[model samples]
Target: MSTAVVPGIEEIARVQGRTVRVLAAGQVLGGVSFGATVSLGALLAADLSGEESLSGFATAAVTLGAALCAIPLARLAGVRGRRFALTLGNAFALAGIAIVILSAALRLFPLLLAGVILIGAGNAGNLQSRFAATDLATPRRRGRDLGTVVWATTVGGVLGPLMITPGEALGAVVGMPPLTGAYLFSIVAQVAALVLYLVALRPDPLALAQRIALSAGPSGPVVESDRPVAARYAMLAVAASHVVMASVMAMTPIHLSHIAHAAHGGHAVETTEITLLVGTTIALHVLGMYGASPLFGWLADRIGRVTTILAGLGILTLALGTLTLWPDEQPAVVVGLFLLGLGWSAGTVAGSALLTESTPIARRPRRQGLSDTTMTASAAVGSVLAGIVLGGPGYGALALIALAIVAVTALLSPLGRR
Candidate 1:
């Protein structure tokens, strides 16, 4: 079970290096798989459900799935190690991918929702992989190592949305419904991730770290700091940031589609053309979400974690301002989405790093799992509410609602300081 006993710090560093690289590779594939979900999930769901308001349910379902799985996956990592938990998660995604294809072919909205929820469960692995990078890391380099893994998602994140054309072409060969073709590309990518986890993740990071902590005796290496920022603040920051981002991001595609519909005089717009616009915009957003993670991580380590988190909130507020001001402009939407991604990256990195350093080694996994669950569930609620808001007050209203959250989070963040 996840063994590769390290004799010393040097050996541990070597192993940590290997673990980061492997996890980075896995992240690349995970990012690719997620591209389809974010860019096309709402589109496909709306088309199948024939109810525009239900579009948010796509994002909600996936996030809820991840929320439900977060703690269980963490406990699994605690018991069986990350290798087993990550691989099992990937397996669920693979099956979900198959189900999505079948559901799309049959035009079954409920089945599609089920498939996507399972895919979200698989996403728990992607979320946790960054934390795994910190397992053997010394306190000094924890941010950098975690950010490196986060940055690796940039490549796949940018490319996954761009896969629409080729993915559709590949799917036409097999007669898949339009948006569902992107999931075809996802299948291959996720399979690669599954194999990578099974084959390369030797000396499981969490398990090995647990062993090392246990060797330090009962108290577990005293990871707690004398006046560390309240872990609750870090968790709250993460959850709040995620909610704003997910709410706005989840509604974007549908908003754009409405524009397309209006532009075409209420005539049906070609799905491909709509997806093209969505793919490009979402690609930029994904790029922002992951591209500067290293810088954010560095800032967290150098400039104080709370400061970095506040900066992220500021960016998020500005992003909402842009979207609320120009709700109908595609270029403006692109800029806003990109900013949203950047803000998410900053908050997620600084907040997660702070939470990690603040927590005890023995409690780290459970606490981190709780944070993920809170973050993911908050996002799920936002997305569901986003659909209702978008359906009622429209996109600008949605952005303004998100803006209010950024303001609230920024005001409360400093109080988390011990």
Candidate 2:
């Protein structure tokens, strides 16, 4: 049997503050890592592969990598500790950055894809950090605490893309090829996160939480882990919300590009112009995604988790409704995408807090890992299916389809435990 050692209330409280700060710092750096690559990865793939069509695969590769890594890393946290798992994940990202730079220089497409995949895997760890924030939180304040960490993401996410210009200059100074320089920043950011995890994430929140739980008994406190309903609902809420967000967000750029092409009357527009439009719109979407997380998190705590989740669905419906009704309008699409990000933030933050409180401490790691895996996998599937749907019926139709998904999710919400 595992030894029953639990953290004292005062110790947990003290460490929780430190843990949040370190994790927040890690998120900022992590945002730099992911934000840079996600924007640049496809462009790099297109350049190296000499195939524009192949560019789409870059994001998919990252999504697949994150999905594949989520469960194993989560389980690692179960065995080793949050610090170990987080450090390993960021290290993988740092390594990926190196490989991406080398692959660009070598003109090796396969190698580039491999590197992108590893970056995705590293993202899986970044996703898990939200849950780590809740390991020792009181139920009354869980959503608020998790939201604060998530809110920290706004700083990094916004800064990541903007850093590209400077990152490029830095890379040029050091003789890096164009487009590859941004990843140099990625490397630095990821390494900083890795070091932060190593040095500051002391006492290992999950491990310490485990000890605190074990002190409750051999089975640990809160045997709800033995019950499937609450855990399953929490997981479903997060996964469903992610799928909707990913599916819609994935198609928005393609739809915008098509609009640009049509508006230009088949004249070839500069790729950079189209990219700028897409990038600016997406940046706003990301802002809505991370910037207001603290508000939603607070709402989740104050209004109740399931209520906030349902409210997220309402936002999704409004966003999708806008997209469906005004598919050809650029301004409407931009607004819709921003709203989509807001809805995702609310659902993910609230659902995560719910998952933490609902799951048993002894089984927390595996379940949390599994939830992330489910969330990422569903998103991958959603994004793929979205492309198909968008290609077949058109952008408006795609919004309608996603709206149906949100409806189904809302239908299921009634079955969830508060």
Candidate 3:
């Protein structure tokens, strides 16, 4: 017997439109906090530890925290729905930001690390928001929907780093440490994000999608199994790309600072100059990361996920190559970083779409969580190693190491042959 049809196109579109709008708004606000943190994380670590080598530890802690929180958040999304999971994650981030301010005020390194990790947990939730956009999406438009949410981050991400100077000014006025200023802004933005999710994300997209699927009977999108191997490859693609991005990105500010100081003939870099350099470079990088996601998503749908992933690998290789060849050139470094963000966007968007399509509905959340866990964990390890390499052999060496990883990932990619 024939099964009942799923919801009509108009109904699905209505839900998808609302879901995307809410998710996009949340991403914009959340991106502000994330962008500020990324710009300041390693610098804060350097200040707290009094050692450049340990700077990566700050970002590493964040990634590790995200890794630890990934599964729990995913399970929460699975059981409680996306609104609950997203809000809870934001709450953790808000708390963590408060602790970060306290840690900075006290000069407590341990507390700083702990607080940053909690912030990372919030980041885990932000990452998952892209997937939430897909619950009500039609198969044909999944990539586009997911890419739109990813693209939404660009506004806040670019704006966040630019706030560094003003944040510092605000902190100084309030007797807070210089590095801690951006986090105050982070707190406000994250709170706004939390409130938005709590208020705007009504009807819980995942729950609604499941209901529609069930009502459609046996012919619905729900399936019993998926190819474990393909899912694993998709996870690997995302993880490897993230590792490259994180490792290089974690140390870039430090690298730039060092270059600036050296350029000034061993004089300390001017704070204004440092802020301008880091903020502009990171803004460009953020732009690369999210600006063209819609295009990449379109490519993923048209050219195929696997093929798009391979293209990401190629872009990454070029990025690493640029950095490796011209480690000291500011323009080249900017180009390299921009390419790095673009490559990450391509890999993550395409890999996520592939993984989602390949997995059964019932298993999707858990598997997606696992994928993010692995991705962040590996990135944490890479960040730690990046610190060591940057301290010893320098940025060029780090680039080379990341390049080797990308090569290995390409070889293992299911799309390599395709």
Candidate 4:
């Protein structure tokens, strides 16, 4: 079913304005819900298992669930439209939160895993929010629109940590633990998102897209209709960048700990201090990721997408090289992380905009879905691989791995040119 129908360009323009606002709201709420649960997975797992090794399992379960469902979920969005898929994903997330609450009450690990998995599937939906924004935008404004939605996410992500505090207080009142209460907050956020999307997103973007497709009357090789090798390369480069970012970020805590220990002459930094530093680093990185999106989008618009993409790779290369030079310095580590975030933002906006530009409307959803699924999977791989490499080859080695990926992304620039 269509969310809203437009008769022509004027109508489309009016609809587009409303659609962007609604989509941005959805992105923000989605980010909050995602952040609420994800930020504390380790603590929940530790409370359940009492062992650090098993705590990793919680994250693993979630990522595995998302990875498994990513491609299928994207295809589902393509066929069913983003509205239905997004709503269903929210439902899964709600159920997951409920399950976690129940599991925490009963002290059940398996149930926790189940809950986390569902949350991961919800994340699959969350990742596509940017792509959904692109659907209603014109070529000239595609990246900006996409970046705006992505930027909206920053609001919710920032609020998520605070959500847990209130959740904990409520849980204390209700006889549930603070952690269990956090899941309830997640449920509430997801439900609110569902309502906002259902009401505000209007008829549906995909349906509007179909109507636009029918109305356009054979425009110059509809962007979605054609798929060049360059498009595929763009997708690969985006995914690879995600992989490298995830892997390196995953091991940052360990790397930082090593630095602390060496600096202390074999005595590691206090756990609390390390945690605080890591938290700050991650927050800064996320800011860098979303904060610069608009600028990157603007850059992609002015320069060719390939040029922006290559610039991102060049930044990434420099960031990795810096890390390699001073793996133990906190300032350098922070700088590297910030640059990594900036590079990802640049590559993501440029590459995704290019992908949208290349494909026709009919194929856009599925292809975009494919791109997201691949990127998500790559992120999962990078997270796991970073742990392995950090344990064995060391943090410096992880920097080299990032450098290698940057090289590959740089090589793909030619594809975008063609």
- Model 1 over residues 118-143: C-alpha lDDT tens digits? 98999886899988888777777788
- Against the true structure, what is each candidate's TM-score? 0.96, 0.91, 0.96, 0.86
- How far off is residue 207 in model 2, in Å? 0.9
lDDT by candidate, in order shown: 0.87, 0.81, 0.88, 0.73
Best by lDDT: 3
Locate the minimum summed-lDDT window of 10 residues in model 4. Answer: 216-225
Q: Candidate 3 versus the native: TM-score? A: 0.96
Tens-digit per-residue lDDT, 241-358, candidate 2: 8888877776666677778988999788775666567667777787888899989989999998889989988998999999999999999999998999899998899888878877
Model 3, span 391-414: residue lDDT tens: 999999999999998999888875
Better candidate number, 1 or 3, judged by lDDT: 3
- Of candidate 1, the 10-residue stretch with the lowest lDDT total is 218-227
Error of 4 at 190 (Å): 2.0
Residue 118 of model 2 has an lDDT of 91
Which order, best to worst by TM-score? 3, 1, 2, 4
RMSD of each: 2.2, 2.8, 2.5, 3.5
Question: For model 2, where is the 10-residue window of minimal lDDT?
Answer: 216-225
For model 3, the local distance difference test gives 0.88
